[model samples]
Target chain A: MLKIIQRWFIRYSEQDRKLDKAVTGITGRRPYNIRLYRLAMKHSSVAAETVKGFKESNERLEYLGDAVLGAIVAEYLFKRYPFKDEGFLTEIRSRIVNRESLNKLAVKIGLSQLVEFEGRKRSNLSHKSIYGDAMEAFIGAVYLDKGFHFTRRFIIRKLLMQHYDIEAVIETTTNFKSLVIEWAQKLNHKVEFNISETRGSKHNKQFKVDLSVDGEVVATGNGFSKKKAEQDAARKACEALDIP
Target chain B: MLKIIQRWFIRYSEQDRKLDKAVTGITGRRPYNIRLYRLAMKHSSVAAETVKGFKESNERLEYLGDAVLGAIVAEYLFKRYPFKDEGFLTEIRSRIVNRESLNKLAVKIGLSQLVEFEGRKRSNLSHKSIYGDAMEAFIGAVYLDKGFHFTRRFIIRKLLMQHYDIEAVIETTTNFKSLVIEWAQKLNHKVEFNISETRGSKHNKQFKVDLSVDGEVVATGNGFSKKKAEQDAARKACEALDIP
Candidate 1:
């Protein structure tokens, strides 16, 4: 039994070397524990057989990675913005870790090409979050294999510093709806959103949303969705009111 | 000006030593960066004045600690329960780290006696979550001072392993309503909770709730609140059905 287990591990180690090369190409660091990276890439739908009847997927790793990533980001922001309040820190962190942001980051890091999932038909049909989930699981794998400071350096230097434009993210007010609402609340004013128009076909529709503050229409915007339109209008309103 | 600044540091370090002794007693380890621990014990309401006009409070540290604690817990759960799914892991993590749990743990570690806050009238009026928040901030301090491995050992050995009974926590179904609902969903069975009776005056009211599964009554419970009554009913129902 011991010999058989050793042989099995040797076979898997060869497979792991190829993956390590790919991971090194992206991360600029060879992984210490290749099994973690393998598990990180594995999707829940394609569960591998284990001695315990079935191998678990990247879900747990994703969960772990998400938390670790959050801590790294929070610590980074805390140190970077010394005079900034908790609210500012929270907003910036939210902008950084939001689903859309992570998904975009995942795609930029070539994660879409590496994740192990079912065929394109099944994956594209239902798992829009697969790439982002894999990105998080990969981070978890890095943390487990390399520890916190190393993971922090990888995130800061390799991912955020090398790839991302932090200054642009800070300057942009893309999540205008939330920002506008928050600003209004701070000023003790009521804010309202109204869907003024919905046009075009069922499949390809356009929405016009009007944002009002203290019962006065402040801005109007049009987009493919109500949420988008509201955000657009809120952006214009913030620009007009000098909300910063 | 230089002499004044030097004097301030001397005074603060003196205070920090007392705090260090208290922390040592709790963790069985001497803290290296005593300033972080000092910040952890200092509440926001009593912000100390500094040469920079106002010294920052523990709020930022609390935020950092909360994220670090979450990561630590996620790592612990991930390694400990290899067979458990993400949902099960999340549930157990929540049980360990939720506000009430942390508050209890904080009191157990004698944190309530060491924390510095405003006088009774100010702190008692609003800062109910002080203990739990300080507990998180202290964890953050530990991470910053000692790094991840030492922090992990401290949490696993000093807090979770030494102080907490992990097996009892796993076995006890404190959140019966969620458990029963999860079980019902797995079996494709409908569950309904109805408040059967309300009695007594406005300030001292009682509620009786009945839980039904698949249109049949499974159990009944009574309590001071509707939520409590529902939970009571769910607990009995879970026992009756032997869902596990």
Candidate 2:
């Protein structure tokens, strides 16, 4: 199984020799447990008709992979781009793990070439969606085969680290918190987000937000809803500061 | 363009010997015109990005495939199971076109093998999602390759025509409408969904609902005020009817 997996990937990595080499390198260091990876790639449809002795498809892995991928991506994006706000991080994360992007990564990693099937009719279809799913599965597989720490290292080095461009990212991005924090962080300053007042009794409370830096209020906003008001205030602060 | 298209699918179909032989049995030709069939297999993501000189992706095909797959599946299920209601149709559709199912179809069609990508990493990934996505894309591809008439025919043959055990499906299914209407519809059914009044109507409006399946009034419900009341009333009627 390990040999089959290795040979399959080695043949599939047509675009980038480096990526192919990386996959081969992993197997060489210690033969990857292909079972986990295979299960990760399983699709439920393929698993559905199997009477018995069937490899359960990747549904379980997809569930686990979603959480694993989300955590890893969230952590890396959170710390690497300290100035970035929630929205900024979300967009990049979306860009990174969205179906299209996942597909792209799968293509990059050469996971699509290693899929196996019992039937022949539907075998020659596109692997874009599967590639992305499998990539996530592969990540999940690595974590299982090796460990989280090992998987984390692979993710950071192979995917995230190379794409880490905080300054360029901030410049290109347009999230209020991200822009403000990113700019402030760049300028070597700290930002203070304080809810100056909460009005309108507990029954239907309203928050008054004052966005400030260095004890100077840059923006103020209000909402029947506190969160909304804070977001509005933050947005205004970002604009007025003209930082990003 | 059509000839080139025909040639493409013929070559593609040939890769899966069984499917190729099966298709050839129908067309009795080595290369056949299957533009719509190919389009059905196309994923929307691929179609969207094709202008980037990467026309091989199935993203767009996936989009159209989704709709085609849904419609055909719904129609077939509707006919096959005379006792099944709208809800039953919906459930079956969900089951058939769901991410897991489509991935299986993709695998069945060997769609992952047909996708043109830069390398095998993508293919090595879960062919399930791509298979499913491509299954939708394949449906889309079929729509384009064979047009609507043949596409629907193919759907029945390939998907719904197969014994679905829809009677069993009906028993296990929940029919909200039936639950609401069973009592009234059975006993002089004259249900009227009247909106008595609406208040605090914003983007997402709150509705007032009343149940009067027959000339007899059954119930009234209030939610967020009125609309919620009507829905609750309908829910109550459903319970009274004793339809799961």
* Candidate number achieving the greatest DockQ relative to the actual structure: 1
Q: Pick the candidate with the highest TM-score.
A: 1
Candidate 2 chain A has its poorest 10 consecutive residues by lDDT at A11-20
Instruction: Write model 2 residue lDDT over A134-188, tens digit each, in one string.
Output: 6776676666566555666777787665544445544443356667777788888
- Give the best candidate by lDDT: 1
- lDDT score for candidate 1 against the true structure: 0.82
Badly placed stretches (over 4 Å) of model 1 are A1-9, A12-17, A49-55, A121-126, A177-244, B1-14, B48-55, B121-126, B178-244
Tens-digit lDDT track for model 2 on B67-130? 5565456545544654433443455667666787556555554555554333345546533465
Q: State which docking tier applies to candidate 2.
A: incorrect
Residue B205 in candidate 1, Cα distance off native in Å? 42
